[model samples]
Target: MSGNTRGITREKALQLTMRKCEWCGTAIVYKNAQAVYCSSRCRVYAHRARNNPFAALRNEKRWVLWDTNKRPIMPSGAPASSTDPSTWSMGHVVNGHLNIGFVLGDGFACIDLDHCLVGGRPNEAASEFLKSYPKHYIEISPSGDGLHIWGTADEGPGTRRIENGLSVERYTTGRYITVTGRVFQPGNLLPL
Candidate 1:
């Protein structure tokens, strides 16, 4: 009842096990056995709560690559348009290369805010977008003129739109994204 002490009766504990954020007391709508937090911020707080050293690299699934002409290529020298993330190798990523794509079938999707990078600066709007999911993996686009927010989003299935001279696109499944650990914001995995 005081100083982080919580008391719950049997009925209350049972009900809570059905649904509640372990971190903040918010009601978790999609409560699963592994569900713990209500938002990305809460998730970050939870992971940081434990002070784990390698919690940051949870998303380092694999490295991506592209051809000399800036085309995405798989590890076997085939066009990367069709490849599995399981086979993506870190040995292939070239430094300062223009094209990169994570192997396909990985659950992560990309929220691409195009043209948000300009004049050696990331646009304020792009920063805001990145902040919206502070736990997601983010990076500067190949041209250094855009932002790539990588994490789980609603399965957008290649939705593309334009707003305020920025191209906002979301891709879910079937594609490996241009990935660079050059994160715009780094912490925990993004909330689903």
Candidate 2:
């Protein structure tokens, strides 16, 4: 014991401090400090709990679109024909010069975060914002600082909330995210 009435010792406390799963209370050891759940199932359940119980039909895959001058365009550098991938090209004319969008239809949406990046990492405010939805597919935008959060949010009109260091935009339909597969946090598809 480390001078405690309950006889709890420093050794015991140290062992319990970082090795327990936050969801199931199981003992675990993780090399990554961000790990919390003991298993993906627990993680999934916890993630689903944060969302509304609305059922959504998910599409299997999505195509990336391109745009510039804040006017969205297809990957072929032409005006987007439809939100569906079938109507657009997946290749960009000037890869780095062009802004991008992801076709958002068939029950899909995304949360976009910009300007919350510092030295290839998200700042405290961005990290805090992401914690609210831990199970969504998080991708680092081509800008290397922005973030794209893809999931099954409602097809309601897009909404944007901006802060001093970050801008958060959400879109449900007729919106395509600039495509990048650089996953920061890998998890199953999110649902609403």
| RMSD, one per candidate, in order | 7.0, 10.7
The total of clashing pairs for model 2 equals 4
Against the true structure, what is each candidate's TM-score?
Answer: 0.60, 0.56
* Top candidate, metric lDDT: 2
Residue 108, candidate 1: alpha-carbon lDDT: 44
Which pairs of residues have clashing backbones in candidate 1? 100-178, 101-177, 102-176, 102-177
Estimate, for each residue in 1-192, the C-alpha lDDT of model 2 and write its tens digit. 569777888677656556766544578766566788877765654554343311112113344455544555655556664454565543333235445445675555678898777897899889888887787777888779888877765468888887655689988887767656678777545653
lDDT for 179 (candidate 1): 62
Those runs of model 1 whose alpha carbons end farther than 4 Å from true positions after fitting are 1-64, 83-100, 154-156
Task: Report the lDDT tens digits of candidate 1 across residue range 60-152.
Answer: 545557776766675567755534555455533444454556643344456777888768576776655555665555677776777777654
How well does candidate 1 match the true structure in TM-score terms? 0.60
**Lowest-sum lDDT 10-residue window in model 1:** 49-58
